[model samples]
Target: MHVFYTPDLGDNEFYSLNEEESKHCAKVLRLSIGDKIQLIDGRGGFFEAEIISAGKRRVDLKILSRQLAYKKQYHFIHIGIAPTKNIDRLSWFLEKCTEIGIDEISTFICDRSERKILKEERLDKIITAAVKQSLKAYHPQLNNAVRYKDFIQQDFTKYNGNLFIAHCEQDSQKLFLGDLAQPNQSYLVLIGPEGDFSSEEITLAKSYGFKPITLGESRLRTETAGVAACFELNYINR
Candidate 1:
């Protein structure tokens, strides 16, 4: 069944697809009246519906069966990383992480960050596409970019034990994230930029109780490290 993003689809029997979705349904997918389709509210709402009307501007459907909390993951994965130099790589990270089951994302500008600017709108579209492709019941939350220092200093009293910072800097005390993260916990892991987080930045994060962790032996790019951390957290919970 073809699935469409319908975040606004609250409790309703009949719904109309917006212009963009309508165009894709009518022209691209060639779906017409009486066709069966699926709709996701991106917040645990999964619905089955049959199209009643189709047009270039709007597609109306009568929702049949509705399922809530469909395939929702148990653990919460929130990754805070610097934006990659090439946005395509960042987009790849976002897509893969969403497919793998991430709950939240935060792009913080680090002291060594090579790319300071980001387009949230574009990133949102990428995440939405990934969610549709992966058929996720929940949408990942994306936070606006903030400075690493400011991001770390915020009240994380909630994630005291689950908080981590993935850095390349040598630290004998550093533990593997896969081994440290416990299941069903809310995790917030920070990743640095191409140049990596500055020593002073690392110190500040530690002072805030963010323990340093290593992703692996091989050095990873900013985007790759973000994805690696995301995958490790998801994998461990699995």
Candidate 2:
């Protein structure tokens, strides 16, 4: 069954599905009255519904079953990364990370960051598609671009879990993610841009208690490293 993203979802409430979603359901899928479809509110709620009215412009469904999702026993992976030099590369990272069930994402403008401004509208579309494709119930939250200093300065009080910063600086402690990460806790990892984090920026991150970690022996591109870190944490807990 094809899953649809419906933010206005509610129990026993009739929602006129969005035009694009309705078109896919009614025209593309050729679904009719009484057909079953799955709906997610992108907020940890899942619903099994049966179509009440099937139209070209809208599809109405009655909620047949509802499930309140539980938080997974895996770390809530949050990646603070430098945007890739290319917009497409950054967009690809967003899509893959969402599919792997990232909790949140924050992009920062580092001294070496080549791309600063991001297109949130397009990123939202990619996230929505990834959510549906991955069969995930909640959409990952995306934060607007923030400066490196401001981003690091924000209180990480809620993030009681471990924090890591992947840097290429010499003599920095090499952290094995296996030893640092655990299941069911919030985790944050920082990936630097093309030229890497400046020494001063690294010092600030260390002062903020973000332990320096290395991805592996071979260096990775900004986008690749971000996705790699996301999957590494996700797999460990799953």
Candidate 3:
């Protein structure tokens, strides 16, 4: 079944679809009256509705049943990384990470990062598509790309979670992610770019209470590391 995300959904109600969604339902999918579809509110709410009117400009549906589905809460995994130089690769990471259940994403401009700038508008579309594709009930938060120093200084008070910085540099307390994750606690995993975080950058992270951790033995790309961290957290939680 095709899942469409509608955050405005309420209990046992009907809603008129947006222009874009209407076009897709009326023209692309050619959905007619009485056709059934699923709607997720991205807040653990799912609605089963039947199309009442499949207008080209406005598609309307009447809600038949609405149920609340519990979302993943074992841990909140936030992956902070430098966006790959290739936008496509970064987009791929966003899609896969959302599917695997990442809570938040922060992009930093590290000293060794090849790409320093990114467009949030484009990234947001990719995230939206991913959320719908995965039938997710919550949208992962995405932060704008910022300087490495500025990124580290933000108030982590919102995150009462485990903090980890995944770096390639040699560290005495390097532990695999599987060994560190604890059930039901929020987690934050930081990943660097292809060039990796500079020594000074790593030191700064450590000073800011970010624990140094290792993902695996082999070297990985920025996108790969992000996806790996996301999947690892989800797998452990599951």
Q: Which candidate tops TM-score?
A: 1
TM-score of 3: 0.95
Q: Which stretches in model 2 have alpha-carbon errors above 4 Å?
A: none
Work out how many backbone clashes candidate 1 has. Answer: 0
With a 3 Å backbone cut-off (N, CA, C), the pairs that clash in candidate 2 are: none
Judge candidate 1 at residue 228 and give its lDDT: 89
Q: Is candidate 1 or candidate 2 better by lDDT?
A: 1
What local distance difference test score does each model get? 0.90, 0.86, 0.85
Clashes of each: 0, 0, 1
Give me the candidate number with maximum lDDT: 1
Off by over 4 Å in 3: 158-161
lDDT score at residue 28, model 1, on the 0-100 scale: 97
C-alpha lDDT of residue 196 in model 1: 87
Model 1 segments beyond 4 Å from truth? none
Regarding TM-score, does 1 or 2 come out ahead? 1
Against the true structure, candidate 1 has what lDDT? Answer: 0.90
What's the TM-score of each model vs. the native?
A: 0.98, 0.94, 0.95
The sequence of per-residue lDDT tens digits that candidate 3 reaches over residues 1-238 is: 6677787776647798889888988899898898999888777787788999889999999988877864647567788989898989999999999988887899989888888889998998899889989888788899999998998887786556478899888889889988988777788888998888899988998888888888899889889988998888888888
